[model samples]
Target: MDYQVNYINPEIKLSNYTGKLFKTEAAFTDHLLVWLISGETKIIQADESFVFGPGSTFLIPRNQLATIINIPKDGLPHKAVAMHLSAERLRAFYNQESIKQKNTVSKIFSFHKHPLLESCLASLIPYFEMQENFPENIASLKITEAITILSAIDKDIGSILANFDEPYKIDLISFMEKNFMFNMSLEKFGYLTGRSLTTFKRDFHKAFSITPQRWLTKKRLELAYYQLTEKNKKPVEVYYETGFENLSHFSFAFKKQFGFSPTTLQKIKTNS
Candidate 1:
């Protein structure tokens, strides 16, 4: 399979991939607007999962953790156009507007076949070819159009887009339990949990009586073991989803922790 990403600028891109499925854990720093042109995408969050087929458009709020899977379906590659709605731009846009902010929870907002959003995103397609000469103001205008459309469609969007506060202190245990499957640095985890690195380590020790790295590895490997032995899932499928970066690393860690390889456990479970 071939993979390509064309950037009209740092904020806008067109992605095309053929053959194999691609998966990754992402922590979005800016709000993302994605318009799928072909194939399928499944976004798995802490509490919910969403699947978007061809022609689906959605917005993912910033400072959120998710596992994204892109699959090539029906002989077509997984192709999509993504626009990043940066915080800097949003703050500037809302400053001159008289929009009221409301408190809202972070979640993926799907705009299914919305004509306005489709038109807005589709207009950017040609700009991918004009990469070198793409006008900055034109991109800004499109983003403004998108923000306007979103505000008009959803009344509560003002809060999500305009409220730029960092994550407040959250329950570390609860947050970690729900989001342990995502592979992120300790620093990122600390920031998202609303604590400094030192505070995070101190709090984590008080809560779990173990180092963060040790706790995370133990939890991930236990989950992987359960998935292999009880769920009968493939090692390939379990590794990345359980927060490990690669299969070899996952296998090594799994063996060291459990005294047997994931594949060995799977075979034993199957034969028994």
Candidate 2:
């Protein structure tokens, strides 16, 4: 099927959504980006599991296997847009003859904040829903905004080319992905990361804009959703697998995070 972005412009297309966990090794013919609006996805690349959440963006390289994991049951409302840059198109769009011909395939990247990109997504609904004038150009403008933001924010370039790089706050996130299934606790995490509990907690909050407990709570909730919808696992199994103390705690937390009880979500899934 043609991706949604294709209809808007010949250069880019948005793929359709599959509600369940997506486990595929597909290839992208053009440069692609998936804007995840909600829920969480564990994208497995080689030995790495990259956890992508709301407002997260990832790249799919041309002709590569992208094994998507932990597709949320309440499949996140998301949009995937791709662009196949041509020399003519590049010149017309940016008035630049030399847009770098980088072989960016199947790579993962993140943008914590980009106003143009944020604005583009905000306008997506109206741009598509209303039968307004110059929709193509308008959507094109949004795509351009996304491209511009990406160019400005992509840090991989300077680090590799200039050899000057600093650590990102996401190093902790990488550690979490590797150790989430283990008996990981706040104290243990602090110890492993070489910081005192108080300092670690403060730094984590400053970095993610949420307390570590809150972050762990959200992560566990996401894990539970994945287990419930994708794994077809029992509630008891989910509770323990997600590191919850008991069923009561799991149910309470699940309800709070998803606005529906686990049983209710299961029933809906079964019926559908």
Q: TM-score of every model?
A: 0.94, 0.44
**Candidate 1 Cα errors over 4 Å, as ranges:** none
| CA lDDT of every candidate | 0.90, 0.57
- On residues 58-175, what C-alpha lDDT tens digit does candidate 1 reach at each position? 9999988988889999999999999999999998999997766665887899899899999999999988887377888998999999999998888888889998889989999999
Q: By how many angstroms RMSD does model 2 differ from the true structure?
A: 15.2
Cα error of candidate 1 at position 30, Å: 0.5
| Candidate 1 similarity to native, TM-score | 0.94
Model 2, TM vs. native: 0.44
Q: Pick the candidate with the highest lDDT.
A: 1
The clash tally of candidate 2 reads: 7
Residues 1-272, model 2: lDDT tens digits: 22123245555444444454433433333445556655566655434557776666665543333445434435443344444433343345545423444443325565544565655554554433444353567656666665566666774432222211222234666666544543355765676555677877887877689888777788878988998999888786566556565689989989988999999999988999
Top TM-score model: 1
